[model samples]
Structure formats: structure tokens, C-alpha cells
Target: MSTPVVLIHGMWCTGGDWKRVRDLLEPRGYRCHAPTLPAHEPTADQPLRVGDRSLREYRDFLEQYIREQDFRTPPILVGHSMGALLAQQLAARIPVFAAVLLTPAAPWGINAAGLANLAPFARVLGRWGFWNRPYKFSREAAAAYVYNGLSPERQKACYERMVHESGRVAYEIGLWWADWGKTTSVDADAVRCPVYVVSCGADRLTPAFAVRRVAGLYPQATHRHYPDRGHWVIDDEETEEMIHGICGWLRPLEQRAARGQQAPR
Candidate 1:
């Protein structure tokens, strides 16, 4: 029996963003699922009050989705950016086969300082109603912040597919305000499953140093560093290589399970 894999996308993106990785994983016997987060569907008929939504709400939504599925074996959770934060929270709440985080945002207590990293959003972050409104990045800004490792042509193509992200969520991540009774904190002691963290050196939004700090929290985690890759590693030129790396990591875990070995919690 193959382990179920759920791919969670970051802010300003939808489940479709995981298409490239899903396409590769599915053919290799992994049951891949990339569900869009609530209020994040790009073509929704009505506007969502995402400003009122919190990190707990997003975590709850994912928990419910996985519970409803009731898989035979614990599913592997893979997430990027904000989704990665949710994945970590979910792993602590439920039993999972494993978890993979790509350029994930720093969790509660992790300091992500540096003016240059947040300079692009300076204009909107100060607005009183910022959380109540949708936020989208211009092509040029997106290219610099997210696709710095890609060529000009590829950056433009990726920019075309970008969507608006929830300002409230962004604010929470930026200020580390998601710590509601430790709900948003990644409790390393509680997360017994294997964790794989892949950090991109060129990720301005969530820089390598911050991500490395996150990986350090999980003593049992396997950390991979890509000094030249950008934040959007899953969609960049090294997409295939990243996919292969994930597959390589999962192969041994799957084999252990197949041999009736208990996965360390």
C-alpha cells in the first residue's frame, strides 16, 4: 500500500501550483492530493472574508480534510510557505507518515528579521485595512522576491499565474502573531514523524538562515540546502531535481513500512 501524499501550496498560490510535483509523484505510486486552501481558490464566484481568518482556521480546515479521508495508513504531508506552517501544525495534531517543508515560513518564536526581505510589502503592511483586503504582487516585484533564480522568461511566465494572498495570514506570519495558546507553534517534542526541510538560498521572502533555524528545531529532521535555488524551487529550473530528492527520501521510509517496521513517531 502506497502512502498518501498531500501537497499544500503557499500564500498567493493555489493547488494548481503543485501540478509539476504531483505529476511526477503520482506516476511513482504515490497517491498525490493538492487541495486548495479555503478562501484561496483563484476563481471563486464570491469574495472571502480572509481578513478574519487566522492560522488556526487554516489548520482546522486541513485537519478536517484529512480526517474525512481516513486513509489506511498515515498520509505524508508536504507543504510550501504558509502551507508549510500548516503542515507542521497538522503533523503535531495527527499521526503522519512524514512531512516535507520547502522554504517554509518561520513558526512562532522564530525571528525573521531583515528589512530587505520585507521591503517589497512596505506599502501595504502599514495600512489599517490591509488585512481586510486582498494583496497581489506586481510582476517585477514577484520576480525579485520569488523567482530570483529563474531566467527572465521563466519569471514572467510564473508571474502570470500568481494570485492574491490573504493579508491577515501574511501579517500573522510576518509578526509571529499566530501563537494562540501555542496552537501555531511547531512542537518538536510532539512531532515524532520524520521531517524533511529543504531551504533555498535565494528565497528572499523566507531566507535560508531563517529556514535553517526552523530545521534546527526538529532534532530528527533531515535538512537539505540549495544555495542557488530560489523560493519557488518546485517551479524553477531545478524542479525535477527537487522532486527526485523528495522521492529519494521517501523511498527508504516506504520500504521500512513495507517491511512491517514501525515508523518513528
Candidate 2:
């Protein structure tokens, strides 16, 4: 059987954000799993109190989910934005066949100056009351940060689907009153699996420069940049192209895995 593919979404998004990609991959005989992280899915029984959340909490949730799968070979871990950070941390500790990071946020300790565009929402980090509350960005802000490449109609539709994100996760990434010791850190040298890093030149949230720096950390990483794409490259007008690029990159890795070549531990 082919190894499974786990899709991890970024902040303000749930597993549903990966539906497009999942649909594209499933028909090709790949089993895809897109699990919602803690506090990401709003339910009557589970209200979102984002301020109390932490990066460690999110990482642990993903780790547990992957462990429960009990796959014959480690799954291909694909993540975006904050999910990318969690994927990197997991790859260091687990044996994965491969990983794909799409416009990933920088690891702990890396300066996120590229996200300076987010300065307009900087007040949320300082307000203590916002710490535990669910946070939502205005449609305008969302468009500027993530949907810049989409049409006005498409952008509005995307914004309408966004949910309140954990304020704590936002602060953690923003380095605002976060516990440095508990933040997720990547040990590039410890990650032995092949990695592919995709960057979007128009991504204001995690700019191309920032993403490139992350790609540099992994000596063996294969890097690709889409100069015309925004942060929502996977959902943009050129989504098919983006999906093709990813599948092309995965082909070699998938072949090696099928040949009984174990991923590096």
C-alpha cells in the first residue's frame, strides 16, 4: 500500500482548508488525512478559548494523531504556515518518508520580520484580554495578508469560511509574551527525511525571503518559489499548477519508499 499523506493547515483554518488538495491527491491512489488541530474546530461541546493554547499543545495533538494511525511507513507530512512549524518539529523526532512545507513560518528563534505587514493587527498581542479569546481578522486584512492573488469575489468567499484563530498561537508566532522554552524548535540536522520547501513571493504573512531562509536551514531541502503566488497558493487560481508541482516532487520520494528504501531515521 502507498504511504498515507497528512495535510496540516495553518492558523485561521481547519482541516477543511485542505479539501482541495485532498481531492486532487486521493484520485491518484493516495490516502489523505487532514486533522483539525486543538481549538481549531469550533463545536458546541468544545468552545474555542485560544488564549490558553500553546505551540506545544498543537504539536502534541498532531503527534498523537499521527501515532494513532500506525502506518507501515511514516506518512508524508505536508504543512503550511504554522502547520509547517509543527511538521518541522515532528520530522526531527519521528521517521517520516518526506515533508513539504508551503510558505512555512520560521522556526522559534528565527526573526519573523517578513511578517511586518501584519503590523496593523499588532494591538492584539498587547491586549491581555485578547489572550484567551478567539481572534478573527477583518476581511480586508485577510485579503492583504493571504488572498491578495485571488479575485474580489473569491477572496470574500474565502474570508467567509475563516474561523477565529487561537490568540495564543498568534502571540506565540509573533513572539509576544510567549514561553521560549516551550515553543516549537527545529533541529535541521536531526531531520533526516527529504524535504521540499515551497515559497510564494507575494505571501505577506510568511514572505519568500523568510521561507527561503528556512529552506537554507535544511541542507538537503529542495526549494521552489512561485513569484506570482500569494500565501494561499494552494487555493489560488493557479492551484492546479501548485498541486502538479507538489505531485511532481513527491514522485521520486514515493518511488523510493515503494522500493523498500526506508526513510532516514
Candidate 3:
């Protein structure tokens, strides 16, 4: 049987974001599933409380989902940015084939210096609940935050589809324990699954350097670098090529593992 693929979304995004990736993977005989986060809905009006959520919450959610489904083999957990960090945590505990960390956030934590440089007022807005205020979506700001590398038309459409994220989560990202430092507190060396990271050349939020840094942690893992792609590398014009590259990298490893499992009993 083919191994399952589980796609996890980054902060401020949902499983729907994986639709395109899923469409591309299914034809290859890989069954994919993307689960929604708690307190997040496409049309919800309620505010998400920070105290009610954590990376641990997401880890447990995925664990339970896997148990309930009784997946025969471990799933290949593909995570983007924040979701990548969560995927690492899950792989550390569960049996997983591999992790494709796409433009992943730093496993240590977001750089305090970098955060300060990009959004100097983030702390202030976080503390005062300014981010929680109901303001109409601004295409300009949304593009500035996520799609700086995309065209104006694409940016406009992306902004319309973007959902309102909890200010608490953004604030928590800056906090010490709230980030990967806390999540990876349990020795990262304990994580046994091979991890493959794909780095985009120009991702401002989760830069290529961040992806390179994790290499030392996963000495046995592989890393692929691409030029000029933004954080949304999967959505870029060269997306089909990128997906093929990923599949090429993954298919051989999977075939090797299958052969080993079936070897003379």
C-alpha cells in the first residue's frame, strides 16, 4: 500500500491552502489529508484566544486523527512555515516516513532581531489588542505581509481569500516559549525520521538561512535550494517543476524503504 501524505498549513492559513498540492499528489497514488485547526473556520466571526491554543494542541490533534484513522503506515507530513515546525514536533514523537519542510520557520525560534526589524510595532499592537480590532481587509497590507514576490493581480486575489488570524498567535510567535524553542524542548536528536527541507531563495519571513540552519540537526536528511522563489514557492510559476523535483526526491526513498520491508522474510 502507498504511504499517506498529510499536509499541514502555516499560521494564518488553513487546509484549503493545500488544495493545489493535493490535486497534484493524488494522481501519483498518494492519498492526502489536510486537517483544519481549532477555532479556525472560513466564515467564523469569533476571536481566537491565545490561551486556548498552542503548538502542543495541534500536535495532539494530529496524533488523535491518525489514531482514529488507523493509518497502516506513517504519513509523510508536509508542513509550511509554522506548520513545518509543528510537523517536526509530531515527527519527533510519532512514526513518520519523512517531513517536507517548506520555507520552514527557525526551529530555535523567530529571530528577535529580525522580528524587531520587520515589525517594530508588533509587540505594541499585540499587547494593546490593536490587531484584534475589526478592520476591513487591505490588499496593500496583505500583499506586503505574504506575497511580496507575486504580481499585483495575484496579490489581490490572495488577499481576498486570506482569513483573519488571531493576534494572539502572532504575538505568541514572538514569545520565547511560544515558538519552536518550547516545542522542540524535548531533545531534537530524538526525532528519527529523515527530514527534507526545500528552501525558497527570497522568503523574508522564513529565509533560506533558516532552512540551512536545520541541516546540522538532520545530518541524514536532504536539502533542496531554489532561486528567486518566495515563501509561497509552491504557488509560483515554476510550481509544477518544483513539485516534480519533490516527487523525484521522495519516490526513490519510498521505493527503497518498500523494498527493504519486503526483503526475504
Candidate 4:
């Protein structure tokens, strides 16, 4: 049987963000699932419904979604940015085959703050009550940072798919220490699955420095970097190369499972 892979996207994005990834992985016999997070539905020009919703909501929705699938084997969890942090938390709470965190946002207690990382959020953070409302990055901010690796046309196309995110969730991630809920906390030691954490060299929001620290949380994590790609990875023409690289890493694990041998912890 094919291995199941659940692809989780981050803030300001829905399951649709994994189109490139799904298109590639499904043909290769992996069952890929990309579920939109709660409150990230397209509300176009309307007051955002993500009002004051916490990250815990997203985590609960995904955990339930994964359980309902009932795969013969635990699915591999692949997450990007904030979703990466969610994947890490889920790995600790559930049975997972493995996890691939792409340009992951730092989990609770890790400070990825530097000029490079914080610059992208400078304007977004300027707004009063930003911590209590829904927010989306301005096109200018996104083009300059999130989708910086893409051409103008590609960037424009990707930008069209952007969605509003919960300000409460953002605040939780940015100031995790102050969060009484500890929503972003991950018990790295509880995640026994093999982990692959990738970082984009030019990514301003979640830079390599923070990604490296996230990787260190897992004892068996393999760290890789794409010097050319940033957060808008799937939108870039070279996305196939990166997806193929990730598939290459997953294939051996799939093979071992097929033979009834568990991959190393």
C-alpha cells in the first residue's frame, strides 16, 4: 500500500498552497492530503472570521482530521512555516511515520529574532490591536519577502491565493513566552519519527538561523538548505527540483516500511 502524506500549510494560506506538492507526490504513489485550517476559508473583502482564534484551534482540527483518515500506517506529516510548528506538535501527540518541515517557523522557546527575520513583520506589527485581529501581509510586503524568489508574474499569481490569518495566532507564535496557553510548544523528545527540516537561505520571515534551531530540537533531524528558494517555494519554477529532492528522501523510508522494517528512530 502507498504511504499517506498529510501536507499542512501555514498562516495566510489554505490547503491549496500545496498544489505543486500534491501534483508531484500523488503520481508517485503517495496519498497526499492538504486540509485548510479552521478560519482560513476565503472570505474575500469581508471582515475576517479568524477573530481572536488561537493556534490551538488549528492544531485540534488537524489532529482530528489525521485520526479520521485511519491509514494502515501513520501518515508522514509535511508542513510549511507555521504549519511546520503544528506538525512538530502533532508528532509528539500522535503516531507519525515521519515529518518534513519546510522553512519552519520557530516553536515555543526558540528565538529566531534577528534583523533579517523581524524586518518582514515590521509593518504588520505596527498596527494597533494587531494582536487581537485578523491580518494578511500587504502585497508589497509579500512580494518583497514571502514570494521574493518568484518572477513578477508568478508572484502575482501566488499572491492572489493569499488569505487572512488570526492575529491571536500570530501573536502566539511571535511572543510564545507570554502566551499562557503555550500553544506553540513542541515536545521534541516525544517525536520518534525521522525528521527532515529544510530552510531557504533568502527567507526573511523564517530564516536559516531559526530553522537550524528548530532542527536541533529533534535528535534525528536532517537539515538541508536551498540557497535560492524562499518561502514562495512551490510557486517558483524550480519547485519540482525541491519536491523531487524531498521525495528522494522519503522513498527509502517507504521501501523499508513496505518490507515491514521500521525506519530508524
Candidate 5:
């Protein structure tokens, strides 16, 4: 059996958002699992309560799924934005082979990327009850922030796939300082696995500077900063290079594990 790869997506998107990455991984001796957040599905089967979920709850969902699968080896955890934070938490708690965090949302040390910072650019996301109601940033807001680099047509298309995110989860991320739950704090010391982090210079939602701090937290992390790219790293174009990079990084590790009879899949 090949190593499993869990593809975790950011806010306002479902597992389908990882399509570009998944398509590339499956053909390369890897099995991909992309689980949609609760009530964040394109066509949600359950009642919509996304706004009611906390950061811990989101991480728990990913953890539960992993435990149920009971993979032969610790799966590679790949995540973006909010999903990135979840991946970090999972690695801290479980036995993960590796993690690829793409513009991961801030946990504790970084406050610049919080939802509070988006208040001026996107008021709705930071409005009252943001931590207690379902919310999805408007396309206008996206154009001003996360979706800035894309053309108008492309931006529109990406916006269409957007969905409501958990307000409580937002609270845990942005207002983590006030949270007694300690939801967004990642135990860096507990993450005993290889870590790869990406930060886009053009990204405003998760500032590259703060993301750099994320890489620094790890003992020796692999981080690539793309000055030209925006938060949408897996855009329809100019993505093959990064994807190839990720593939190349994992190949040697997988080969070594296989050679040692560890399988790593």
C-alpha cells in the first residue's frame, strides 16, 4: 500500500478545493483523502452549523477520520489556511510522517493575519457575532485581500466555490488570546515529523512575515516563499513548479522509508 496523504483545505472551501493537488498525488504511488469540514460541504448532508464549531472541533474531525482509517503508516498531512492550523494540531497529537502547510493561519505568535486584521478590508468577517455565526467573505472582500492577484474572471469562478465557515472557529483563530480553550496553540515540540511550509508574499490574509515565524518555530523546517504568488497557491496556472517541488521533496523520504522496510505509506 502506498502512503496516505490527507489534503486539508482552508476556509470557505470544501475538500474539493484540493482537486489540483489530489490529481497530482494519486498517480504517484500515494492515496489521497480530502475530508470536507462539518456543514461546509458544497451540498451539506447535515444541518448547517459551521458557525457553531470551534477550532478544537475542526481538528477533532480530522483526527477522528484518521483514526477510523487506521493507515498502515502515519499519513502525510497537507493543509492550507485554517486547515493548516488543523494539520499542525494533528501532528502535535498524532504520529504524522510529514506535513506541508500552505499559508497556514496564525496560531498564537502571529496576530497580524487574524480575522480582526481583516476588519478594515472585510468588515463582515470581523463583525459582531463573527465567532458565533456562519460567515463567508464576500467576493468584493476577496478581491481586496486573498484573491487580489487573480484576474476578474478567474476571481469570480473561485468565489463561486466558496462556502460559509464556522464563526466559532474564526474566533479561535483571530481572538486566540482571549480564548480560554487554548484552541489555536500548536505544541511545536510534540510535532515529531518533517515540516514544509509555504508563504506567498502577495498574501494578505496570512502575512508572509508571520508565516516565516511559523517556519522558525520548527527545529528545521523547509519553507518556500513565493513573492509572485498570492494566497491561492493552487491557481489554475503557474502551479506546476510548486507541485513538482513538493513531489520531489517527498520522493526521497518515501524511498528511504521503503528501503528500511518502514513502508511510510
Candidate 6:
């Protein structure tokens, strides 16, 4: 049996977004849980802000959840976008078996890649309909971004069901990544667990180059570049193929544990 797997979502999204992925993984004997962040829920009384919470707070939440739940083992932490960066930070502090980062954003520590800092501009542009204009979640933008890797019919169907996100949170992510090391970024060298990062080739939000940088940071990291996929790789038509790739990578580690061999580092 595979170990438990925890799913963490990116900014503005709730744990509910991972339902499809969870369903796909659970039938394979791998238990899956997608924990909701403290303040990201639409039903929350008060929303969280950029400085309102830090990366450490998020890591601490997962750590507590693990301990309280009594999982079979220190499970794999699978995260997307900002959640991916947080997963690495959590692994560094906790005894996780492994981590999988999907199109991880660059950690805040490095100042060279400053593009993330520009995300806040979306808010101002949003007011001017700049972001909502040329690239609004219109059918064309949806086809290009949200549904790039899926079939045309699936793209149209899924895009119809998509909802608008929090502009405040989007701007906050900008500030969070801009002030990463001082606040949100993790120390890559501190992470000792095995790490796997899947880079989305057509991701408009986070490019493959950013994921490669994360791979370069970890001592036991493997990077796979998906040439035709977008950021929401799970929704793509080839998602099952990607899931198989993930299970294939994890199976050997599971077999090693059965043989009393130390889990791969």
C-alpha cells in the first residue's frame, strides 16, 4: 500500500480544488487529504492578508495536522504553485517521506528572479480592465491558459465552470514572493527529504525555468519537464499519464520500505 499523501493548494484556492486529484490517487491505495488553509475559504469571516500569515504558520498547520491525525507514516506533501514552495519548507522542518512540487514558484530568498513581484500590478490593471480585458478569462484566454492541455470540448466545459479568484490574494501573493526570504521563502539546503518537481511547459503563471531552479536547489531532487501541459496539469487530458508517472516514481520507494531498506533520500 502507498503511504498517505497531503495536498496543498496555491493562493486563493481552497482544498476543494484538489477533489479530482484526490479521487484519482486514493483508488491506488494511497490515502489523500487536502487540508484547507486557515483563511482562504470563501466562507471565512475574515480573509488572511499578505503579512497576516507567514510560510512558517502554514507549515506549522500541516505539522499539527499530521501529528494529530496519526497518519501511517510521514506522508508525501504534494503542493501546487505557492503551496509547492510551502511544502518544501514543511519538509525541512518535519519528517516527511517525500515531496512533489508542481510548477513551483521560485523561493523568495533569491532576489534575481523578480517577476513575481509584479503580480500586484494585476490589481491596478484589473481596475482598468487590462488583465480582465485582453486576457480576461474569456473563451480565448481560457482556451490558451486554463484549458491549454485539455481537449477543445473539455476546455470549453471546464472553463464554463471556472470561477473568479480573489484579487486581494493575488496581490498578496505578489508581496509574499517579493518578500520571500525575509518572510515566505525556505532554505533549500535545509530540506533533506526526496523532492520531485513537475514543470508545466505552457504555464503562464509559473514557467518551467522557475521549476528547474528549484530542482537545482535540492540535494535529492528530480525534475521532469512536461512539454505540452499548462499550470492546471491535473485537468489536462494527459493527467492520467502524469499520475502514472508519479506513481511509478513513488512505487520503488514503497517497495524499498517493504524490504526494510531505508527510504530513498
Better of 1 and 3 by lDDT: 1
Error of 6 at 79 (Å): 0.6
Q: Which wins on lDDT, candidate 4 or candidate 6?
A: 4
For TM-score, the strongest prediction is 4
Q: Which candidate is the best by lDDT?
A: 4
Report the number of backbone clashes for model 6. 0
lDDT of 5 by residue, 1-265 (tens): 8889999888888889888888777888789999997788776632266778777777888999999999999899999988898999999999998999998887775665545346633555547766778777777887667677889998998898888877777777776777887889999998878888999887878888889888888875889899977888866465667878988988888888878844232
- How does residue 175 of candidate 6 score in lDDT? 49
lDDT of each: 0.83, 0.81, 0.68, 0.86, 0.81, 0.69
- How many backbone collisions does model 5 have? 1
lDDT of 1: 0.83
Report the C-alpha lDDT of model 2 over 7-96, residue by residue, as the tens digit.
989988889989888878888777899999887775643335554687789888989999999987788899999889889999998878
- The residue pairs found clashing in candidate 4 are none
Candidate 6 backbone collisions, by pair: none
Name the 10 consecutive residues with the lowest summed lDDT in model 2: 42-51
- TM-score, every prediction: 0.93, 0.92, 0.85, 0.95, 0.91, 0.79
Judge candidate 4 at residue 231 and give its lDDT. 79
Scanning candidate 6 in windows of ten residues, the lowest lDDT window is 128-137
Which portions of model 3 miss their true places by more than 4 Å? 46-52, 109-117, 120-126, 129-138, 177-181, 184-186, 261-265
lDDT of 6 by residue, 1-265 (tens): 5578999887545688787788789988888889976555554332323224545566688789877878767888899887887788788777788899987766764332335334434444456422222122557665664556777888777665544444433433444544434555677777887788899777766777767877888868888898878878755666778778888898898888789887777
Residue 111, model 3: lDDT of: 54
Arranged by TM-score, best first = 4, 1, 2, 5, 3, 6
Candidate 3, residues 1-265, lDDT tens digits: the string is 7669999887657788888788888898889999977655566553434223556676788888867877888788988877887787788888788788888766544352355124633533555554343222246555655676889898876666666555544444545454544643334676677778888776666767767876556776678888788877656676678778788878877887877752110
